[model samples]
Every structure is written in C-alpha cells, then in structure tokens.
Target: MTAVVRHVMVRGRVQGVGYRAWVDHEARAKNLEGWVRNLRDGSVEAVFAGAEDVVTAMITACRRGPSLARVDAVQEEAGNPDALNLRRAGERFSVLPTV
Candidate 1:
C-alpha cells in the first residue's frame, strides 16, 4: 500500500470537547502515524499518515468527531511527514501539546 500524509484542521466547537483524544483514538485504530493537538485559535490540528484510503477515512471521520464535538469545517492540505518528524515506518499516533 502506498502511504500518504495529510494535515487537517477541524474548526468549530472542537476544543474542551475531547476532540484531540478522540482523534488520537481513531488514528491509532486506523494504524495511522502522526499527531493531534489543539490550536490557540480554537481549532484542532492533526497530521495523519498511513495508507491512502485509511488516511482518507480518518479525514472523513474528523467531520463528525466524538458525540460532544460540533465539527463545523474540516480543512485539509498535503502533509510532509518529515516536517512533522514522523518516521516512514512504525510511528505511533499521539496527542500532542497545544500549539
């Protein structure tokens, strides 16, 4: 499978609603490697790296985050794994400190 990486920003009532943790859980479950964190702008930022299809599914999932999360918009962009310091193999998904 060809691996792909993406950077996503989830907006709306994302913070203070367990969004990061939910993302961490989902990403791990999909065997994705990257990180999720909250932004001071009241949004959630995440990087997903894995099989192309799996990463796409993860982005779709971000649209309707955990029950409490009211995700308004999900913006996506091409991601550079190197920029995120992700290994091409065996990296773990994690919840990162807010940026």
Candidate 2:
C-alpha cells in the first residue's frame, strides 16, 4: 500500500479543548505517524502519515474530534511524506509538543 501524508487544520472551539490530546490518542490507536499541535489562531493542526486508508481515516476522525472539542472546519492538505521521514523512526505515532 502506498503511504500518504496530510496536514490537517481543525478550526472552531478547538484550542484548549483537549483536541490535541485526543488526536494523539487516536493517532496512536490507528498506528499513524505524525504530530498534533495548537496554533495561535485558535486552531488545531496535525500532520498524519501512513497507509492511504489509515491517513484518510484519521482525517475522518478529525471531523468529530474529541468530546470537548467543537470542530467547525477541518482543512486537510496533502503533505510530503519525506517531511516526516527524518522525525519518525520506528514510531507508530506521537504527540508533538505544543507549538
């Protein structure tokens, strides 16, 4: 299966809403590779990589987000798999430090 990567931006009451933590949990559960962080614009951004289906599933999950998070919009863009190549080594998934 070909690998896929994406940059997802989740808007709306996303910040300080446990979205990042939920993302981390979900990413790990799905065995995805990437990171999630909070943005200054009160949005949650994440980079997920893995099999095409897995990445897309992560995107779908981002739609609902966490219980406390009210996701208004989720902007997903195709990302370069190489962008995460250096950072991920034998890692299934990880929650990046807030940026």
Candidate 3:
C-alpha cells in the first residue's frame, strides 16, 4: 500500500490543553510519521503520514481531540510527507514548537 500525507488545521479551544501531546500519542498509536504544532492563530496544526486509511482515521480523531479541547473545526489538505519540513527522514511522530 502507498503512504499518504495530510496537512490538518484544528481550531477552537485547542491551546493550553495538552492537545499537541494527545495528538502525538494518537499518531504514534496509529504508527504514523509526522509532526504537530500550535499556531499563533489559536489553532493546532498537524501532519499525518501513513497508510491512507490510518491517515484518514487520524483526521477523524483530530475532530474530537483531548477531553479538555473543544474542537470547532478540522481542515485537511493533501500534502507531501516533507511538506511541513519539521520531521526528519525516518523519524517518528512528534510535537513541534509553535509556528
């Protein structure tokens, strides 16, 4: 199966709620390779690279986020594995600094 990548932007009540950490855990559980970070616009941004089904599942998971997060919206777009330019080759999923 070919791998696919997606760039996601999650908005609303995502900051200061351990959302990034939750995302990291979820991504790893799915064996995904990508990075997530906070944006200054009060949103959470993430990338998921893995099998198509798993990547799509990750996007669904982002819609709910952590218990503390009040997810308002989740926007996703197709992307290259290196589109974010944050993760190194062969690296596992991670939480990156805010952008």
Candidate 4:
C-alpha cells in the first residue's frame, strides 16, 4: 500500500455539530493516523495519513460530514507524514484543542 498524507481545511457550519468527534471516529475506524481541530476562523482542520486510497476516501467522507454539519468546502493538500503534529506521543488519532 502506497502511503500518503493530506492536510485538510473544512469550511462552513462545521463547528458545534460534533464534526471533530465524527472525524476522530472515522479516521480511527479507517486506521488512519492524524489529528483534527477547530481553527480560529470557525473552520476545522485535519491531517490524515495512511494508504493513499484510504486517505482519499477519508477526504471524501469529510465533504459530507456528520448529519448535523453543513460542509461548504473541503480544501485538501499534501501533508508531511513524518510530522503530523500529533498532540500526544504514540496516539493514532487525536482531537486537538481549538486553535
């Protein structure tokens, strides 16, 4: 499996809608290594790392977030797998404090 990493920025009505929790659950279920957090500008940011296809699938899922979320945009770009900026050591997936 070819591994890849992606940094994503999700815009729109994502906050206060269990978006982070949903992402945490989904990424872990997909065996992805990453972190999700809320940004200062009312946006959500996340990093996903794993097999290319799986990561791609995760991004697609983000576009249609949780039932309560109204995802407007999903911006994705290449990420550095070696430096995912994980909050705690040895954690597979994390929900980081808002930034």
Candidate 5:
C-alpha cells in the first residue's frame, strides 16, 4: 500500500461543535496517525497519515463531520509526515490544543 499524508482545513461552524473529537474518533477508527485541532479563525485543521486509501476516506468523512457540524468547505493539500505535530512520542491520533 502506498503511504500518504494530507493536511485539511475545515470551515463553517466547526468550532465548539465536537468537530475535533469527532475527527479524533473517526481517524483512530481508520487506524490513521495524525492530529486535529481548532484554529484561531474558527476553522478546524487536521493532518492524516496512513495508507492513501484510508487517508482519502478520512477526508471524505470530514466533509460530513458530526451531525452538528456545518462543514461548508473542506480545503486539502499534500502533507508531510515530518510535520504531523503529534502530542506524544507514540500516539496514533490526537486532538490537539487550539492554535
């Protein structure tokens, strides 16, 4: 399997709506490695690293988020695993503090 990483920014009513937690659950369920966090601008940002297909699926899931999230737009770009910013040494996934 080809390993890949992606950085995604989710917009539209994403904050205070369990988006981060939802992402955390979804990513872990897919056995992905990365982190999600709230941005100061009210968007939610995330990095997903794993098999290309699994990471792609995770991004599709983000477009729908939790039932409560508006999810107006999802911007994506290639990501580097070296920039993951994981919370701990061996964490598989994490919900990071807001930036």
Candidate 6:
C-alpha cells in the first residue's frame, strides 16, 4: 500500500514539554518514517510518512501529546519528511535540535 506523507504543524503548549520526544516514540512505534522538530514560532513541525492507518493513528496521538503538552491544533500538509535518508527510517528517528 502507498503510504501517506504529510507535514504536520502542531501548536499550543507544544514546546519544552517533551512533545518532540513523545512524537519520536509514537512514530517509531507506529513504524512511521518522519522527522520532528521545534519551530521558532512556538509550534512543532513534523513529517509523517507511513501506511494510512498508521499515519492517522500518529495524528490522533499528536492531538493529545505528552502530559506536559496541551495541544490546541494540528495542521497537516502534503509534503516530505526532513530526513537525510527518507528510505532508511528504521534505524533511528531523530529528534532534531530546535530550529
């Protein structure tokens, strides 16, 4: 099955609250290939590329981030994952430094 790829921008109490870490865990667990990072605009942006069901699950999880996060919105767009190697996502899904 072709996977769904989207650029997700999450806003509201998303930073400095382990949201990025939770995303990494959730993505890996769902076997989704993507990269996540903190944006300067106080929102978290990530790319999720995976089976439709898995991608949707990840998006749902993003809606209720880690306990420290109070997610207010989740914005998704058709796009790519910001990884150096898009095909090799099984090794490690990185949690990039703040950008």
Q: TM-score for every candidate vs. truth?
A: 0.91, 0.86, 0.92, 0.95, 0.95, 0.85
* Model 4 residue 74 lDDT score: 99
Compose the digit string of candidate 6's lDDT tens values, residues 1-99.
667787789999999899998999988888777788898999998888888888888988899999999999998878754443543445556677678
Regions of candidate 4 where Cα sits further than 4 Å from its true position: none
Q: Is candidate 1 or candidate 4 better by lDDT?
A: 4
Clashes of each: 0, 0, 0, 0, 0, 0
Worst 10 residues of 5 by lDDT: 81-90
Which predicted model would earn the best lDDT?
4
TM-score of 1: 0.91
User: Which segments of candidate 6 are over 4 A away from where they belong?
Assistant: 81-92
- Superposition error at 23 for model 3 (Å): 0.2
Output the lDDT of residue 31, model 6. 78
Q: In angstroms, how far off is 85's CA in candidate 2?
A: 5.6
lDDT of each: 0.88, 0.82, 0.90, 0.94, 0.92, 0.83
Q: What lDDT tens digits, residue by residue, belong to model 3 across residues 42-81? A: 9999989989999998999899999999999999999776
Which of the predicted structures, 3 or 5, would earn the higher lDDT when compared with the native?
A: 5
The pairs that clash in candidate 5 are: none
- Candidate 6 clashing pairs? none
Error of 1 at 91 (Å): 5.4
Error of 2 at 70 (Å): 0.7
Worst lDDT window (10 residues) for model 4?
A: 80-89
Error of 3 at 8 (Å): 0.2
State in Å the error of residue 24, model 6. Answer: 0.5
Best of the two (5, 6) by TM-score? 5
Measured with C-alpha atoms, the lDDT of residue 72 in candidate 3 is 95
